[model samples]
Target: MCGKRIDHAEWRLTKSIVDIERLRAVAAKHNVKIPDDEEDYYRHLLNGLDATAQQVADLPEYEDPRLQIEPETLPRQWFKQKPNPLNGWSHRAEIKLPSPKDKRLDNRTVAFKDNVSIGGVPLTGGTTPEILTGKSEYPVPKIDAVVVKRVLEAAGTVSGSANCEHLSMSPLSFTSFTGPIHNPWARGYTTGGSSSGCAALVGINQVKEWRKRHGLPPIDEELGEGVDMAIGGDQGGSIRLPSAYAGIYGMKPTHGLVPYSGILSLFPMIDHTGPMTTNLEDLATLLGVVAGYDGIDPRCTPETPLREKVPDYSAQLASFKQTKQAAGEWTTSAAGKGLRIGVITESLAVPNLSPEIFKVIQEAISQFESIGASVSHISIPEHLLGPSIWTIATRAGIASLGMRNMPPPLLCYPCPDITPPALSQSSFDILDRHNPASANMVFNATLLQERPDGASLAAKAMMHVHELRAAYDRALTEVDVLITPVITRMHSQHPSLDAKVEDKMKPAIGSTLNTCQFNVTGHPALSMPAGWGKAEDGDAKMPVAMQIIGKRFDEESVIKAAAAWEVGGLGLDKWDGR
Candidate 1:
């Protein structure tokens, strides 16, 4: 084993690595000193620690299931200075690993968020090596994320990595190492992030495809090639917020529905990664390919179905679309005949929600009603407190586990590519320069760690999650889907790189007001673009989205509702003031 193995009793007797100074330093930090009589007693007790650690250290590395990628899945190339024009691509996926045996994602090109590992590819988590280590280097992962394997197994071609917000922190774009990710709908503004580039690429693809289908010309030549779908991560509102701003569909499936193994996590409890696509059909299909219990992440419980048993979400949505139209009625109330929609009364009360954006969502609801779905205001008072609960429950844990890369409280896969040296002033400055939101989270954690009641406060907030979930459950009992707006405003322009932290972080404040609740409640939430809204700073019209949330593991209803509203009602890619 590690060095020569000695007798079991000898470990306790050996000097090992714990020296007198080391023990003294630890004691001083706590304002304590070992009595002279007990010095050797304590020293010997601590000396055995290194020997015990060596035993585990000498053990073989874990055989990660993510490493079982089939042949032909080798990665291609990574980009340097100039990223794709939209600043979307982190690399080019010249490698095509197709499974002729599969159909769900046959020939679809899919990009994984930079934080999700793709074997032999650099896992950026949206920062250069110089940001963390003062060297231009990045960790190339040897394993593919569980979702990557599943996507390939389903016949999807890997379309390389997409730029994400630095360390997957910000809810709005402009925090990426490469640069800002332009919103496809409004070039100089944001494509909300840390799933930033994923949304940008998918949004562009959606627009181009929609135009081509209508016999219109291509939007531009800037979008070189294309991606049909993207697998994006979400801890707070990364996926949904970006999708909302970019005018596409993004889903955060029930917490455990999609195995999160091999992806960087912000907090083990809230970690999620799901599909973002141009349309609901692709979203449903890609989600099915990546979902189900992988027997790795502990988040997946006994209730999680086996991979083979996962529901055929795309097929089910198609069936519902056909079933509704089979009635042969084109009247005002034919499409959404049996759907029940709930508007979260508290969601509309968010402090900064603009009247114009409010009207966009209101009109979306009316459109649902016009297509025959019954709508009512459903109140969950706890929703007002959701963002607060999410913060207190997750901040310290995210600081200790997410930012610092420490071991978590549960058994789950941790993407080893992310190894931070430790939390220090230098590291904090580097992180803050990239994304102030992340720095704020770390500071909150630091403050909490010093308070005696911090752990208990977090625990109590976690307990309240059950109350919040039950409240939503009660609301859902009265309706099939619960809907809310994704954000209070349209995407904003990126601040100068050297801008003040407060100024840089301004756009992200309250950005997650309506999205983070479900992250903690473990519900399936999707952001569906309802219409367009005028940009606050420009003549450009930005995409507006309304969220659709469903009961845990009931993604079928969530997808079906959105699809009906899309295909059977007002249809996708709608315009403002329509």
Candidate 2:
């Protein structure tokens, strides 16, 4: 065979026989005495390496399961901006894939975050312009992602791709190239991200107004024929933050409960994808459709039971209705009776927490007593260390490692033929231009720092994460569920794009304050809107939220508690454009 180019990636061998011989010749030219035995030994090592490399090269190439083409049962319609309000559209497409006989989601319209692959279209993680513009060098997927396939089989129509934080790296939605998504409750206020668009689209008035602006007929809520749920990916707080800000129900299921096979993730351990919907019932239904083992994503915990083996969450909603608390007879109320709820004191004790938000959440927590649930303060002092742990793990463990690794053919997919989009120059350029100080800080302080330090930091963070998980697990033995404010603040106007990076980073600091810890521990958590509260120092009425955290794989307890809270008139089902 002709000599392979050393630089060609297909040639796996870095030092070939020819190159080894050249080294030997150069050593001889320098009069370096290589003993005959040593020379023969070096040649033997080279031969072994070459043989191993050739063996690998001769192995059959991997064929991605998703690349197998099939006849189209559903057609797709794409657009730049058709019915967008709130600046939430990254790209809009309508999907009508064929369904299985048990059509559970036939009445629902769902939107997916841009990171989730919708086969035959580019899966932009909110960074690649080529993908955004439909000029990606990669082949359009021939089959949908595992989650996308599951939703289709359940008869859910995909509305389109919702905008997200760039590379799903930032908690603030402003980082997306599509521009900051506006909160539906109040314009000029931000919709928290990286799953910003998912929650905003679920806003009842927001969707209605957008339809009117587009000259489309009004959404007949009576008929329930409109966007119903949105699928959101979370490394930290992407799903819950937006849900908290927009006043919708959002969940971050236990890690590995839902497959991350087709989602762009920051790290395999931290990645979670879950439902953001207007109601608990819909959230449960959508969760049922998406949560299951797909056998492709290795991040899924082996030996985990199938989703079918778990209790039907949709049916569990009715279990709450049968309780005595469903009626007004408090003396005989059986609902939430003997349920122990703990309010995480550390989450509320953040010094910057708005007084208005604190008061609202306190009042909401106080109501658990009315439903026969006992509430008390609980302390996990290490909870304050969550941000540091998340930073070290993601920046050191994921960012640094991702930089050195060769680009894969596709993210979270098995497609070998697709030329995955490179990390675009514009993505880095935007960060450099807009947040040079932050970029430099990340680059110099962590990524390019001494390699040993990076490794040590990541290792330490992981150990602390395990310790934290154990602490929470111990706390769960005392309390059935833990409660915290989803965010430190209630609401705020959007920050200016020209704002300093430090100023931009401060608001987002609290965005993941209470949420990221759960991501680290792989616990099931949900955000429920408590009620409307006045914005700090402002007249705008905005939503306040409380987070319910349950033990790992105990999503049923979390869901039941949330549903009971809502049924008791303590939860806000809609913002009502207040």
lDDT by residue for model 2 over 194-276, one digit each (tens)? 88878777765434644475566764432122267889988788899888888788999999888877565567778799999
Task: Write model 1 residue lDDT over 1-578, tens digit each, in one string.
Answer: 34565565775566547777888887899999999777765666666666778788898667575455566664356544243678888876645564445867776889889988887777788876754434468887777889888887777888789989988989988998788888876678988988998998898888787668667777666655558899999988999999999888899999999998888878888989999998877888898888899988888988889989999998898788677667753345667778899999999999899776798899899888887888899888999999999999999988888875666878876776466555567666766787777778777898998899988999999999999999999999999999999978776888888999888988788899999999999999999888877776767777789999999999999987787676434434465232
C-alpha TM-scores of all predictions: 0.94, 0.82
Task: Quote the lDDT for 382 in model 2.
Answer: 84
Report, for every candidate in turn, its global Cα lDDT versus the true structure. Answer: 0.82, 0.70
Candidate 2 colliding pairs, count = 0
Task: Show model 1 residue runs off by greater than 4 Å.
Answer: 1-13, 58-60, 74-83, 98-100, 130-136, 213-217, 329-332, 567-573, 576-578
lDDT score of residue 490 within candidate 2: 63
Who wins the TM-score comparison? 1
